[model samples]
Target: GEREQVDFRTSHRRKDGTSYPVEVHLQYLQGENRRVFLAIVLDLTERVATERELQEAQRTLSTLLTNLPGMVYRCQNDQNWTMEFVSPSCQNLTGFSHEQFVETRQISYGETVMLQEDRQRVWQNVQEALKNRQPFQLSYRIRTAEGAVKWVWEQGCGIFSATGEVVRIEGYVVDITQQRALEDQLRKTERLAELGTLASGMAHEIGTPMNVILGRAELLMRKAPDERTRRGLETIVTQVERITKIMNQLLSFARKRPAERQGVNLEVVMLDVLDVLQERLGKQQIEVVKTVSPQLPKVWADPDHMNQVFLNLILNACQAMSDGGTLSLALHPIDDTVELIVQDSGSGIPEEQLSKIFDPFFSTKAVGEGTGLGLTVVHGILQEHQGAIRVTSVPGQGATFIVSLPIYSEEVRHEA
Candidate 1:
C-alpha cells in the first residue's frame, strides 16, 4: 500500500445516488510499523460545464456575424483608425477581407475606405462624439472596388479606459446606399410637387399677359405699311410662338400626366427617341449605342409619358456634348423594376450642381439654349408613373442617368 500515487478524473457516485465528474488523487505511505492510505477528490462537473457554455456562446456569436447584413468592426482611434477586429461580413461592405483591415498600417479606414471629400467631416463628427462620450453616426459615400459609388452609414463609440482616456473605437457599418437613394428620390418628388403648385399659379398669372401680347402683335402685323415694319412684326409673331411653346412645356411639367397603365416597352420608346434624334446626331457627328435586352418585360406606364422621359433625357445627353461623342442606352431588369441606363460621353456635371439638376428652372446651358424645364419635366413624368431616376457623373468624363420603373406583372395584364 506504500508503493505509488495516482491522479485522475472519473464520475463519482454520491451517497444521495447522484453522480458527477471528479478528479481523484490517491496515495499510500509506509509508517514505522503501519501502512497509511490517503485520497483526495475534486469535482470537475462545474468547470467542464462552464467551458462548454463558453464554447456554445462563441459559436452563436460566430453564426450571427456570418449572417449579419452589415459589418461589425473594432478599430483604434488613430489617424488611420487602424482596425483591430472586423467581422467576416466586412468583405461585402468594403470588398476587403477582415485581415486586410485588422492592424493594417498601410491603409487604415479613413484614407483608403472613405470618400476623400467626406473624410474631414467624418473625422470631425466622430471626434466630437468621442469627446462628448456620445455615439457617432454619419451617412457618407464610399468608392467601391468596382468604381461604383456607395452610400454607407456608420455608428460607433469610443472605448475609454478607467482614467477617461480613449484608446479604441467600435461600430457597425451598414450598406444604406439604397435606403439613402430612395430618401433622396422621395425628397425630390416632394420638391417637384411644390414646384408644380407654384408653377400652376405662375402660369395662370402669365397666360393673360401672353395672350395680350399675341393679340397686339397680330394686329400690328396685319396693319404693317412698310417692308421693314412687316419684318419686325413677323419677328414678334415668331418670338410669341416660341414663348407659347415654352409656356406649354412649363404647364406640362406642372400638371400630372394620368398613367394609362398599359404594357409599355421602354426600349421601343428609346428607339423612337433615337429616331427623332437621328438628324441631330448626324449634324453633331454623335454615335448612338443601344444595348437594350430583347423581350424584356414591359412596365406599367403610359407610352406617351415613357416616350417623353426618354426624349428629354436623350436630348439632354445630346445637348450636353457639343462635339461628337458616344451616347449609350442600356436596358435591363432589376428585380421587380426595369432600369434604363442612358449615358453620354459629354462633359460631365460638377459635383456641387448634381443635387440641383432636377430642381425647377435649373439649367447649365447658355441664354436661349434651354428653357431649364426639360429635366424638371422628365422628373415629373417619372414620378407620375411611380418611377425613379438617378444620375452619376465625374466632371469632364460624362454622365449616366438611371431610370427605374415598376415592371408590369401578369396579374396587371389580366386586370387590363
Candidate 2:
C-alpha cells in the first residue's frame, strides 16, 4: 500500500448536534521511502462563539458596576494611588470623575476624596496594609459637589507580586450615609430624653423645701412689727410663695406620683380645688361655673395626686382667661367611667403645638413664668391611675381638657 497525503476543511457535529467548522493541516514525512500525514484540526466555531458570549457578559457586568450608586476602584501600592480602573460611579460617590482620580489630575486618590481630618489616618492604614500585605477596611465621610457630606465604607485586599510585594489594591465602596444619619439622630434623641428625665427629678426634689419656706415666710409676715417691715415681709413672702408655686409645677411635670389607690369622690375633689382657687378667681373677676352630677360614682386613685391634677387644670383654665372669662368645670357619669371636663374662654393652645403640650419642658409661657411640665405631670398621673386625658382647642378661642376615670362599683371594689 502507498502512503497518502490529505488536506481538508471539515464540519463535525458535537454531542448537541451543533456543527463546527474544522480545518486540518497535514505534513508528509518521506525519510525511509515511507510517507505519513500529520493532521492538525482546528475547531474555530465553538471557541469563537464562546468568546463572543463571554465578551457580551463582560460588557453587561461593566455597565452594571459603572452605573452603581457607589465608587469602585483598583489602586497601586505607591501612595495608595488608584491604577488600572475606576468606576464612573465615583462621580456620584465623591463628586469627582474617574479621570480626576486615576491620573491624579486634580489630586491623588487618597487626597482627592478622603476628608482632611481622615486623610492622615486613612493613609496610615494603607501603609500598614502595604507593609503587612493584608486586607484593609475603612469607613469615612466624603464631601460631595453640592456641599453635602456622605458616609462611605471601603473594603479591599492587596494583590501581591511574585516576590510578595504589594502590587495593587482593589475594593468596593458603598454608601452608608443614611445609616450613619439614623444613628446620629437616635443618639441625639436619647440624650434629650435623658436630660428631660434628670430635669424632672431635680425639680421634684427641690420643690418640697421651697414649699415649706414659703409657708413659714407667710406666717412670719403676719407678726412683723413696723409698717415698713411688714410691707417688706409681705413682699418677701409673696415672692417666696410664687417661687414655691413654680417649683411645685416643675415637680408635677417631672415626678409623676403613683396613685395611692384610695376611694375618691370626684365631685368632692373638684369642689375642693374650686374652693382653693376661689380667692384668686374672685380677684381676677373670673367666674367659676360647675356642673356636677350627683350620681357620679367613686374612683380609685391617690387623693393628693388627683388634687394636683384638678388644681393644675383648673388653674390653667383660670390663667388662660387673664382678662376675666368664665371657667367651666363639668362632671358627669358615663356608663363605667366618670368624665371631668375643664373648659375656659382664654386663649387656646396653638394647633401646631397642641400635640407637644404634654411633652416635658415644652411651654408657651414666657421664660421664668412657666416650667412647661404641668401637662406632662397631669398626663403621667392619669396614666398611673389607669385613666385617660384628652384635649381640644381652637387658637384664640378656647381650650377644653377632658379626663376620664374608671368608676369603681361596690362589686368592683370588693373584687379588688
Winning model by lDDT: 1
Q: Which stretches of candidate 2 lie over 4 Å from their true place?
A: 1-233, 249-258, 410-416
- Candidate 1 has a TM-score of 0.73
lDDT of 2: 0.78
RMSD of 2: 12.5
lDDT of 1 at 13: 91
Each candidate: RMSD: 5.1, 12.5
Clash pairs, model 1 backbone: none
* Each prediction's number of clashing residue pairs: 0, 0
Q: lDDT by residue for model 1 over 68-108, one digit each (tens)?
A: 88889888887576888889997788787777787444556
Tens-place lDDT per residue, model 2, 81-171, is 6556888888888777777776656646565556777877777887787687778888887777667767888888888889987777888
> Could you tell me the TM-score of candidate 2?
0.48
The positional error of residue 73 in candidate 2, measured at the CA in angstroms, is 32
Q: Indicate the worst ten consecutive residues by lDDT in candidate 2.
A: 250-259
